[model samples]
Target: IANDNPYKYQRRLASITSATVAELDVAIPDPGLTTAVAVTVSDPIDVENGAMFSVFQAACDHEFAKLIRHKDLRRYHSWYQMKLREALMADQRDETIQNGYMQDSDEWGLPLGEVEY
Candidate 1:
């Protein structure tokens, strides 16, 4: 059996997180002998979201030079990149707060003291 394209798997996983398969217009393929299948949809919303995520990930994977060189797509690519960055930062902040790594001024308990040798 041929191995599935890892990129397709990544795209499907991303799509599911951002939108449901139905919302993404993704069609569930009939079970067959093939071990690998590409998950895609005919809906414009699904297509745009999938493409945006793919391009953003490509840029993050060190393909920013190539992505930015496309003048027509630069705007969309930049928007996706910024959105992804913001989402990541928000998630990190939430995680840090939840783990007690961050504290608001009102939540500060005490100040650290310098220890002299």
Candidate 2:
């Protein structure tokens, strides 16, 4: 799931992700512990432990580079664009005092949305 290639509507996350916080103990791979162990995407939790975030980061970095090099968004798959969008929105919303939106006009982004691309 961290690769941004979660596959077919995010189903790959089922083994590791959950809606309830109570189950997070085992469902979520602890970044510190899992980073050192030999892990795989097939692991019951986390593809790289916390290091998988780097995988996702690498994917994003690739898209960014592609955009810079070609001035286009057509090369990457829709899933890549969708995840990037979500990540951007989350980052925008995470700012404590200034999140790049004006209360008077700019609308705060939702955490999730229908893929529009």
Candidate 3:
């Protein structure tokens, strides 16, 4: 998943400044890598900063609810799904507004319809 969309997750480029060979061994426990001199770590997304995060969280909850057999949980899942959809729509609206403003700006030149042949 990280390979597919690297930009979606915030990546940090870090270098091991000072570490003994034994310390390096303990610090970089992932055996798959040959060296641990430098590493790129993906930080967790700030869910509170964007609507997309809430949408993703709600979707995950909805899917997880399917695995359990509970009446109230199912209801909660439905509510969450609805809220997610609303958030997605709101995000779309906001994007559209921003795009419209960008297009209207003199920096972008005349609007499409106002463009002279």
**Candidate with best TM-score:** 3
TM-scores, all models, native as reference: 0.22, 0.21, 0.36
Candidate 2 regions with alpha-carbon error over 4 angstroms: 1-76, 93-117
Per-residue CA lDDT of model 2 for 1-117, tens digit only, reads 466443322123333344331122333344554323333345443443333454486567657856687544444434444454455455554443234322332332322222234
Global fold similarity of model 2 (TM-score)? 0.21
What is the clash tally of candidate 3? 0
- Give the lDDT of residue 43 in candidate 2: 44
Error of 3 at 80 (Å): 2.7
Query: For residue 100, what is the lDDT in candidate 1?
Result: 25
RMSD of 3: 14.3
Please give, for residues 27-109, the per-residue lDDT of candidate 3 as tens digits.
33445553544334454444655667677777677667666745557565656545555564666654422322233346435
Error of 3 at 98 (Å): 20
Candidate 1 residue pairs in clash (backbone atoms < 3 Å) = none
Ranking by lDDT: 3, 2, 1
